[model samples]
Target: MSASSGTTAHAPSRAPWLWIAALALLVIMTRLWMSSAVSWDQNEQLVWSQRLRLGYGPQPPLYTWLQWAVNLVLGPTTLAVGLVKNSLIALTFVFMLLAARQVLPERTAWLATAGLAWLPGIGWQLLRDQTHTVMLTCAIACTWWLVLRHIRSPRPLGFVWIGLAVAWGVLSKYSFVLVAVALLAAALTVPAPRRALLSRGFWLAPLVTVVLVSPHAWWVLEHWDKASGSTLDKLHPADTPSRLHGLATGSGDLLAFLLLAVLPWLLMATYTLGKFWKAPAAPAASADSKHTSSLPWVEPLLRHYAIVVVGALALMVLAGASKFDGRWIQPLLLMAPLWALSRWPQAGNNARGARRYLTACLTILVLMCAIAMLAPLRDAQRGNGDRLNWQLDAIAASLRNAGFDGHGVILAEHHTTGGVLHMLFPQAKVVVCDADDPGFHLGCAWRKAERARAKGLPLLQVSTETPAPDAWWWAAWPIGSMPECQIHNLPYRWTDPAQAQMQLEFIVYPADTSAPVSAPVAARPTLHASAHSHLQ
Candidate 1:
């Protein structure tokens, strides 16, 4: 519901710089001190950074391009890549504050800003990984703020920004298509905003957005399999659930997830509301103020927020995508605290409630940072590790010690292994041999390796398993044409002692013209037991 237009703006009761500064420091320190191993998403970005393009395997290129650019200046270390994500998160927090300020006073605005620390999706996902979805969260925050501003002020530039933000959001992740639809629907549903739909300003921003995103759109059209295939894999309907059952339960399950996600904030909001209800109500408005009441019953800002979230849930149900990642809906909740504060006017102004909100937010941040630091150490002690825990430098050195002259291609059956090799050995073309799996295939690299084979370059097949007679490589080259191959069992140990180890071996296939390089004859590396590891 809309607030009275005649409501006078009060002076902000507090400054927000301290909250911003604290958040900045927390982001910086966590990225610096957290585990050295990159998460799955971060590792993918590192691989994507090696070859910059407008589109990559089954996703848009904006986030990967951003990482590549950031890594250029910061170096491709775990900290530098994480800083790009942290910076986006910091920007999202600022944008959230700005959006809140439009509908809320400075004190409530600060509360909403700090409340971001409570969203696990924001805290854990944004802090831990620099993925396309994280970038989409930042884009969504910026878009919503612009959309709200445009609803209030009807500025041409606001629409342009809304258009740009939506375009960027979609380019970051395809799911943002839902966000763009929700914003447009919100604008059309409300009469004041509906009027602008016919205006030139309304069309200008979308036109600019179309112009900007046209190149990427062309790339998507050309690479339809990559663009759409990834989405299908995630949303693929399960046969076991039965279509009717999935449809029946999807929306309720989604709504329940949303409720549980915000339970902590809801509790605090309820307490503030309780205190507001007990306190004396404000005096009745003057009769003259009736004419100043806002149009469309609901504030367009709140209307847009509700519409976006509900619309997403509705879409999910209709599509029968019963399963969803909780973090996917993070962008919709950016203004949740602001919306709550607006609903209970007293909560926005209550000094005690404001203090408690800040304190709670700070406490959560501290606890999360401590957990982030300790979790990896605990994982190490337990002999657990993620894919990123491997010793890439050592592996590269070991490969050099064997017959690899740094002139051939290194092909691995797993994306995890290939991604690390690509990052470590920039000179060699690292190819993922498992092209049969659509999700892991890098078409360009696979083709490049084939071309390299035609030129008689050495090919090293690296795998965790021993070479079998009937592997994909065997099919690629005829038995008579195949180069002389030597099996070298090298123990690839984890750099972190707390992490487990594996027996990774390299199958060296020398070029037809070249002599067989001597293997590690006397020095057999010690291998550790293969322990379980989690992927991010």
Candidate 2:
């Protein structure tokens, strides 16, 4: 019998509820461990918490608002945020399993959910709240809903759903534009969906998204030239680590990282693909006309999703041509766990291949979760200096004790430190504005790049190799790329020996008379979240 016939004709003896329950239980446990578990993120979350804007300058306010709400209700403790983040992650997996069930077997759906829960990205999101996970989950859910609608009707509502999903995804993170692009263009990949282009609902979605995102739109309107443009400049070949080299770095990590995220989903998705890709040679004698033994109409939907997955990857490669972060590809990562879970095991009722893979994946996850859970392990990880670049707390404390209020604006040689300090003091206006660059150096820092100039006067540039002196010398400040002498140095005393270990720490106290006063004025900018449909 054809796969299409399987859906409509007779209900199989397969035990679906049990499989779904197993998936749900695992997802719950996995999320509980992952959340309240992560202590850090690159810097985006810090910016939002510090500034507390209607929308963020670069990122949309959706994730920020969502997180901010959680923080408000639960208190802004990392543990609190982690809990909510973890819960949202679990929800995403739940929906992913639902999506998997529509096409794959019970066994395959379980496998996909397992793959997704164990995906490293999902783990990271669980450990800490990532806007991408929240937003992308919505986008995928929207996709699932839209496809279901399309299956039932060629109505414009399907397109409207696509538009709204894209808009909301964009609201969560700027990167979601790629998904929107892919979704809008999905019709071209599959012949059946082309009819959606003509639907009134399809056109209406963009309009609704725009209306919803107008507040943020105005923010971008005012500051894109000032802030967003600067960020884009950093992606140029010259500003960042070598483009190819950077991509390769992320890709290597991605290869292993994404395997966990998407591989399972891929397996699950394939179950559906396999079913319809090569179904019955002719209509089954026992099947109804609506339920054909021939290829089910559902084949196109699977193919459409496949095209979306592949198309999104192609776009990422193009985006990565400049620079990439593993997190950047997160929107599409949901598919892996789904596909991975859906593969039917070759063995008997014993469940071999899928079960074995699931077990192996879960075992690795347990080790990782263990490593993350142990208090000693976390403390060790934080100060280990193997992963983190420097200990900002120690450095900040030293400056504060040395008569600095922890309120002064920071000028750093590298933008990362500037970014760090910005997080350190949300109340202060930390600007790369010294060089007209607006106070940061690269990556997210340059989002306000147009404002920075090369003002060659250097900040306190601490070398990575040298053990920092107890007293920061006025001589440590450099006139050029390398400091002629160490100037304005300060010493730090740690209660624990663990804190004394040194790493690279550069504090640029820009030589400005009004540094203190100017910071507060600059910190006044509000959040800007844009959701526009005009894609060039």
Write down the TM-score of every candidate: 0.81, 0.59
What lDDT tens digits, residue by residue, belong to model 1 across residues 1-536?
22445455565444576567676778668756654556567766776786677788777788888887886786667666777777787788878877766555466567777777777667776336647767887888788677656656676777778778878887888778877776677767766556555565778877888987898999999999878876766665545368877776776667776775676666765554344545553333432222212123225546575767677677777877765666776556656665655544445566777677678777777777787766655655566644444555656676776668766777776655666666666566666655345433335434644565667787776664333223344434433343334343332232344344544555566665355332322212211122122121
Alpha-carbon shift of residue 67 in model 2 (angstroms): 1.8
Write candidate 2's Cα lDDT for 328-354 as tens digits: 555565564433222332111235554
| Model 1 ranges with Cα > 4 A deviation | 1-15, 195-200, 238-241, 271-300, 403-408, 435-446, 455-460, 464-499, 508-536
**Which candidate number would show the highest lDDT if scored against the true structure?**
1
lDDT of 2 at 114: 58
| TM-score computed on alpha carbons, candidate 2 | 0.59
lDDT of model 1, residue 302: 61
